[model samples]
Target: MFEQIKVFFMKIWNELIITIIVGFFIRSLKKSKELVKPTINELLNNIDYNSKNWKEEIDKVLEIKTTVERHFPEYKDYLLIQYGSSVIPDNKLPSDYDFIVLLLGYPIEGNRYMHNKGTISDESNETNKDQVDIVFRDYLSFLFAASAGMPYENSVIYNGKLVKGHQGYFQWLKNITKNILFDKDFLIRRFKEKIIAEKQEFHKCLKECEEFGHDEYYVIRAGYYYITSILQLRRIQNFEKVITQNQVIELSKVRSFYEDILDDNIRNKYEQLVENLKRNNTLDLISIDDIKEVLLYIGEEYDKNK
Candidate 1:
């Protein structure tokens, strides 16, 4: 009789422990959801351009240009291509100056060569939020990349405006940009490369999502790139110039096509993820499996098209 009583009590104790553990897990999930709610709300509603400091921001960019010119006088013939949020009109909190310093009269070193001069930040003012990213490349290399339909070049060069450069260099860049769209072979090769690169990035994001418990940012980023890649491929097929990368404008341009191409459920999930991310600063609610599914779908589509 005592043995039977002991066995019954032990079983009850084990069951109670499991119930407590399950309760804690559910509570943790709920707590994480709550924590992310406020950030999402703020992201969705904050549309202020904060353009009152435009002159100040321009001054900062010019200062950085002067400093870069002074330091790299040997490359004084470089073209300064300005891009990113700072260049976009009505961009909220445009905080950084992005530059691609293309050195004219330099030879291409083995296809292409790139060197990055890390970001510079102001130390004098506590509230100074200005930053500069200076990327150096030979002019020939830049032209080649643009002509070859390199994904990075497609996104950057097409959107960039010459902030400070010689008239001749600007004209050359403009002509080359137009001519590259006609190179069918180059566009085909570039499309293939983009597919490989995006697939690799998707896998890396999937791994990170599994380990970090947050797939929202990765999913949104992957979805954007996937859609962008598809648009580029379609443009190549139709002999159209790839569109410029104004996130709001460009995304909208491809939205209808993207919606038609992607599975309905995947499309809806991606849209929701983007909406959530735009409002929230943190990644909290997401499913890794969903991200993987979308990525796989994108890859399959690319394969079929290629």
Candidate 2:
């Protein structure tokens, strides 16, 4: 009886010990995961936008901003204004957000330069990578981009917030944006240069896509150039005012104004391509042959007009 009692107690103790060990292990694992995750404030405060290359900079900004806006809703108030597809209300698609941001009391007084404070990553959702570009600028840098006739400045002047605050600083930025963007000669020269650049980019992306396989990256870029070239060509031809990408797509869908000049088949293709780009965030579904043919048509039209 004594021996049996001892064995029973020993068995109970063994099971208890095993349970305690497993519990401890799980607790440690939970702690480690908590430590690995970054705080919301840390993520928001760490955005870096110092790249001089506008294309590369915008790419990074969009990737970072998507995560920021979804995870943190408070930051939307801080957003000055959004350009691009977000400016369109009825056109609901998973489009990138291109906007300006105001981060108060940053970079410090003496060390007041666009330097990063920390870093952020989106390990949670790897598949659907929503991207939007955010520009964090001080007064002088904003003025510089406005005065310098950079391509993106046109978007801001048209869509960005035009309010007065911080000692009428916002108004100052607005005035500068208008002064530079609205000049007749400046628009003419800028549109002409933009046309050439877009053509080159469209061909370059198309060639790479053909040489390499049909990659989503190259297709997206090609689609961008394709639509932008059409819009710029129309603008230059008619001496029309500036319009956003969404505006151009809208006009194309109805075969209105400049878009009415497109061949019925070309107009249909343009409509299909733009819709696919908007819905899937890529031009993967569109056929390469179709793309080439449409591009050829666009080139012919441009040549005739030019």
Candidate 3:
């Protein structure tokens, strides 16, 4: 509860900063920005894109790097994953394929989530229904949050191969999440009533990818979308339960129950990002035009591959 209050204030602080930046011109704006703040904006603007040095941490986790480039190539040059700590310092990069997709996504067709109450305009304690816990949140979702304003870890792609990790590799998108998006005919029938809860929420996650600037964050979070995918094992996890009882209960809901995410510090960061987006008027910054560009890019790429 106290942590929530801290989160509330942090969010406030961030929004204040954004408003100051967007509302008026301050000669000291650049100096006011957080230095070494571990934000995507900082990384993009500061890092030398030509750096040859990168993470050589893991010899096992393979899925990390390839996943980033495939879905989020814009960040291909900057993302990397290290396996152990102490071997490295002050650069505690997240898992190999961090910051891939968007999570805490906006609403979609059906599934709706929680919201915060009691506030004064931007100062309110609003919690978007989409706020899933960080651990259960698909680490990539966490990565996306981190990448929004921090430096994304970097890596190099070699003929579609990684320098190290092999067994740790994984599928691109979650099977369930993908199937929901595939949104076809017979495929829909096969899925039948299997949608336990928050079906629209699935699509919302996809939509969030586009909304959140469709940068390195989307690619990283997309992998964790696979977490939504463990739907295949839902029946067994739930002991032959169907429809997840209500909207909230699910066999895999357990995944979203990680306590690590509830930490005040993490929540503080989440609040800050929300505040920044709101203050910068970056919250819905991606428009219909951006969506069109993305669709066109995807189409052209698809055609070329074919």
lDDT leader: 1
CA lDDT of each prediction against the hidden true structure? 0.54, 0.51, 0.30
Per-residue CA lDDT of candidate 1, range 1-306, in tens?
A: 999999999999999999999999999999999886432113213433366654334434345456545544445466667666557877875344456667655333532332321222232122221233355666776666665655455456667777556868767766766534335555567677766676666666657766786534554556556545665565556643453323212423343454544478777655544433333322344455655566567656766877
Candidate 3, residue 28: lDDT: 62
lDDT of 2 by residue, 67-147 (tens): 445643333322344566656766665544445544333344533233111112342122322343444544455455456
To one decimal, what is the Cα RMSD in angstroms of model 1 from the true structure?
15.0
The Cα error of candidate 3 at residue 133, in Å, is 14
TM-score of each: 0.49, 0.49, 0.22
lDDT of 3 by residue, 1-97 (tens): 9999999999999999999887666646655664424333223224342555332322112223454335334332322222122123464533112
Judged by whole-model lDDT over C-alpha atoms, candidate 3 comes out at 0.30
Which pairs of residues have clashing backbones in candidate 2?
62-132, 62-133
